[model samples]
Target: MSGPITLRTQKALVTRYKNSLATAIVQGASVLANEESPKMLAIEATALRETAALVEKALENFTKTADGMEEITEEQDKQIQAYVEEVQAVVANAETLLIRIGAKRTGLQEATPMDEGRRPTVTKKTIVELPEIPIPTFDGKITDSENFWALFDASVHSQDLTGLQKFNYLLKALKGSAREAIKRYPITEANYAAAVELLHSKFGDKDKLIRSLQTRKETASARNSQLTEQRRLLDYLFALVTQLEQNGIVLNGSFVAQKILAKFQPDLQRRLLKQRVVQGNSEELWAVKQLLTDLDTLIKTEEQVSEMLPENEAFRGGTKGRPPPRRYETTSGQRSQMRQNLCIYCSDTEHNSLRCPKVDSARNRREFLKEHKLCINCGKPNHISRECLRSGCTLCDGDKHHFSLCPKRLPTALSSAGPTKSAYTKSSRTTQQPKRADAKQPTSSAKTGAHCINSENK
Candidate 1:
């Protein structure tokens, strides 16, 4: 007597009931947009999907039911069909409509298309932006490292500089030169006093050190000084790190420097607090220095054993530009090739004599002469003498013997007939001077003329 009772039928019936309930809930919740926690805004989505599936199932069942229920109540069947249609329409329309309303109501901004087709909407969805804290960056390192020591390797590699101080001055220049580039003004090896005048001009009279203190008091009273000083402190930290990094102390110096700064700041603040009560120079460099120790002490490491010397660190690349380790053992052939590649003995493009496996070992064979103590010019080994081919004579251990017995040093009759030293000097001095001078003048004049033309063009 229970109509079509089965688990399948019960499940369908439950699904139908759920679909109806979901639709009711969505319609009811739609009015609660004003209520916070905004639950209704999301429910509409679930109702729409459920309602679509329910309508499809309801239609299919209605088709099957009609075949069996022609004998049942016609009015009831029509009512069920109308209800399903209405629910379907409601779900379909409400889904699109509510979503559009929610998008507009929640302050979702619409974007204008820059060109052509349908534009994507751009809305400032409320995002949590964390408070910004400045950080030291690697780029600042490159700009601050202009000192001669920093630039020394580059200069030597390029053959640019001639002196060491010039190299140092160049590095010192990095602080001032990279002022705007660094977050904090560089604490240069720069004469701090001289920079004050410059900073005064650059930062304005308000930017001057002494003037800034008085203003800082006023700003602090007004609550702006708190912000400004914090900014200044941050800037100081950034600049300090930047300078250290340029000097090749990126990892080590920045950490230790920060530690010392942490130690120094509270003391500095107290000193400034005292200065606030007293009247003094608008700019305070001495008090700053007194509160802050010379960076020289900072140069010594934590152990105080040895300091970080710039030269100790590899200038161009890591520790040494030692290429990556070789995978295979070098063969004898490779060693020979390396020797050939690095030949430095002579201008001979043919072969390297220094490490050549084969060399001219005839008479003055270099290795034989060097080992056996023979003269290099004539080259007979073991006797230590130079032998000349022309005279066919061999002397032991020296070159003067060759000069003494030479077949090539005979005098000619014309050579003998030539003028004596005194007569020759008298004639040569009088005649050669004017002619040589005359010969030199035209060529020198031509060179001067060419120089003038080039200079004029420039």
Candidate 2:
């Protein structure tokens, strides 16, 4: 009922049956050898031997019908049967060997059931899902290397990655000097471990790192920027100290505190030192955290105070709002002395108005008034004597005589220089003594007599 099988078709069938028998033999032996239970191992061996027989029969039928011939001679048939029997014997021997080794049949060896009249379906291979791992990067710096190695080691231990996968991840993370060191090595599982070991050797010098950390000191001055920088340096040192201590180095906390305190300014150092003595607290005595808090507060207070006060001109050797003292040259080529009694009210050089004795005394008041040629009558400054409002003498308060002619006041020689009375009054007044016209009367004697008469009238 079926068309004759072509040579190509027959060959394909033979190859397919041979591959199926090979696969069953390999899988069965693997499972049987690995199985612990004797019963399971026997079961798998029996299934494997049966599958091998079916494969052998299929191969025999194809070989007999080779070259498109429907029938094979007795010799050809016997040969095909002999070959199939030999394969069966080999499968049986393999099963016996597996059983001898105490192999048990496992679920892995369980064969799928086939349809009676349908070809066996080929199953596709299943894809396995792997967990994601974060990669680490390194720049060859000691700090970066420390961080990277820590994370890399953790990742390797946590993830279910093969050696080759780990190597690839390590290579991906390499950069700068680190990348160059391992660049020549082949990308392989063995090389990955070696590269990692090499990196550890190159960058993992604990003593060198400790020495470097010991040398680090805060280089910044005491300021806002310096505070930021100092804090960063101190933090770095602390991290380094922790790392060294973990690696079995015994670092004293007090020693570390002393080292940190050495970085501050001299004034800050003195202050902190004083505080330490006063508090007597041994803990965190020179710790940067506490010192930084104090320093920050100090600097902030200083800034606020500075903002409130004017600049220190004294420090600059000058006074604000005042000019240099004026130097006056005298006629004798000597410097004039500075005026001491500069009056605040009247601006006089002779006396200060505050302590001026003439201010309250009526008799001495006219001295100041006369200096400015002011009227003594009304007490107003800047007016002449003739413009005076008072009709009385300034010295004696007499209404009949002017201040210049008052008898109570002493007369200078200049007061007698001019005649007190007019020549007409002198000539008309009755006198007991008469004088010749040629012999002139002394004007001084006549003026004196006239002053006497005037004083008597007042």
Candidate 3:
């Protein structure tokens, strides 16, 4: 940082490095401070401390990436987003739910007493019992999910449990709120495991549950383990989105955006989607659509999550390309003072690069001879200049009318084929907006179906 005014003179730089005078001054100060070298004249000292400002600027190029989230609204879409948020909230214990006791949840909070009010009428088919099968059967087994017959027959609706109680308890035992904390960023497996231990507080000692689950049924335990892993993946997605909000200018943020492969869209939870359908027959379906519109609006303050590892499965061996060149205009005086003999790429004052005709034509015949390349028209490699191809080559045989060995910039054949279903994927998968069409006459949209998990069946 230290330098004298005299060292920055323009004359000292023009003959040598064509560097910044400020740099020369700083180097002069450094040499005098060290005192290891002998004394020198002002001109001699200035010549030694030369460097390019252009090179310094070129070395500092940092690029930014954009977040690429899709937006959609369908009956099933709202359900999935809400379900994801609910899962996060539940796991974070940001909100609490009255839940039922299961294997590890031996300690239970008694169900809050209820005052009878308007309630659904109990019927025979509504109740069913979950048999204590030594092995929990997903299909034919009498399980909690299938216990409608026994539950209603006994006039027993599990008062303490939320709709998510069945699968969440398993997750709660394995995951806890730690998974939700990562909704804003990615978490390592070690962190996820620790979060699981933190979440199993009231449920009981988690180590014991893990031991029990392992000791009791070794085979089914693997399937059960897979479920927790899936939930962790969901958390990782949230983390990815959160990081984007802190960085890139992503297009949009919604549950539909994360689950690009419709496989993860949570279609089974579309209770609201069905409700929207029935209510489309009535008025106010429009209001229902608004709910989803707002839910997708949880976009963070920042955008662009490009720094995060790309989630695209198509990414091949990881090698990002170098950034483009950097150019800044110099003032008229500086431009005038610029070297007339310098090359365009390297501004050294030997020979101007732009006027270096040797790089282009027959003027550099010796270069072509040395490389052993001849013109493509005349059967050659090194001498076939790019300019020759632009003029159109005679090597027109197959589809490659030009360079036979040249590859395409695009990857897939379909990329250039105009439109496809992918363009509408985001819109088709989000909240199923309530019938926004005037109640006076139902529109084609209402008739098709809404994605609301609240009402409409579609």
Candidate 4:
């Protein structure tokens, strides 16, 4: 009973595959008979191959399902075998059709010599010639050995060349003591290996190179701890650590890390420590690694921020739209006696504005400033006192003016009331403090005397 039911299901699966294969074989055969073009034949051939694959898969499923069955009558076994043979026959037909289509495609491709009634395509390719790599010359300096060998190896030594050719190349790339070391060996095929080995021992010794790298790191310094200097120091340390690690020397110890750390300023050292410790990395090796990684991030960020700023941004401590007044120098490097601009007070170019002898009195200075439209405080043109960004007058602690132009620095005869105790004045003055602005008025006699002195000064 189970044999009949199991064989029935297997027969149904194989029957579907047999029908699919048969239908595909008919379609392929029709296309092969009607079409002589390779493209059309190829499309039918692909379809036949897919159908054949499906039929084979179904046959596998049928065999697997029958083997798992517990019992099968002799009649059912014959039926299963018949179904398998039917599916196999359809798959065979499909395969034979595919072969015929392939043969047809080959014949058509050979007969036409060109595809789709068009002339054969002549693809033009632009072959770019590359520049030849020049062999690197070495001057026998231990510091330059690594770079020299790296270039020579890539350009000449490791290329497809005979030993004699390589030997000649090595000769051309050597100079000074480097050429001298290999000069004894005659230029021959057999001496190339010996020469290379000798040079490696003298200059490229692993221990010697490692020791050189250590010396470089030990002597490295960034005293100012400026961003550019710090970046340079970081680059050297990064290269040193990489070279050491490549040579199988690890910087797990604090000796090298501490030495490198000592090269930076105290503030930078504290920053490195704080950043590393903040990330919970207390290991010395981790600190060194963190320092390199952090510096890379710091340098990149600084460069990015710098690139985003406008090129015309004014510098601090400088006047906008105009350069600060500067003394001129002669072609012979001697200081010239002339000022950059004519003095507004004395109208002479020989002396600076502040040092003008004729503009001695504060009243005259104020008159000159107003006439020239200069700032009353700093006495510079192009901006008023309120717009001045310069530091205040040191003599009076006044933010509105330069120290030399301060009224308080002038003689007391310039004003009868003396310097007022304004908010702009510094608190450190020991001179007598004048009455507040809101204080009771001075006596009529005192006011009259003040007016008389002011008139005499004018």
Whole-model Cα lDDT per candidate?
A: 0.38, 0.52, 0.30, 0.64
Q: How many times do residue backbones clash in model 1?
A: 11
lDDT over C-alpha atoms for residue 71 of model 4 = 72
Better of 1 and 4 by TM-score: 4
Could you tell me which 10 consecutive residues in candidate 4 have the lowest summed lDDT? 120-129
Stronger candidate by lDDT (2 vs 4): 4
Taking every candidate in turn, the Cα RMSD to the unseen true structure, in Å, is 35.4, 40.2, 37.7, 32.2
Predicted candidate 1 versus true structure: per-residue lDDT over 227-345, tens digit per residue: 22333444454454444444444333333333434433343344443554484533333332322333223222221432233322311111122357778879989877864544222
> Per-residue lDDT for 333-376 in model 4, tens only?
23333434445454555545554454555555665567658777
Measured with C-alpha atoms, the lDDT of residue 88 in candidate 3 is 35
Where model 2 places Cα greater than 4 Å from the true spot, the runs are 1-134, 217-226, 253-256, 266-271, 281-458
* Alpha-carbon runs more than 4 Å astray in model 4: 1-126, 253-255, 284-287, 307-458
lDDT of 2 at 438: 45
Alpha-carbon shift of residue 250 in model 1 (angstroms): 89
In terms of TM-score, the best-performing candidate is 4
True-vs-predicted CA distance for residue 222, candidate 3, Å: 14
Residue-level lDDT of model 3, residues 321-358, one tens digit each, is 21344497778677665544443222334444222322
Residue lDDT tens for model 2, 180-279: 8875554445677788888888887877766655555334232322333444544565565566666676554566666666665445556666877898
Q: Order of all candidates by lDDT, from best down to worst?
A: 4, 2, 1, 3
Q: 51, model 3: CA deviation in Å? A: 38
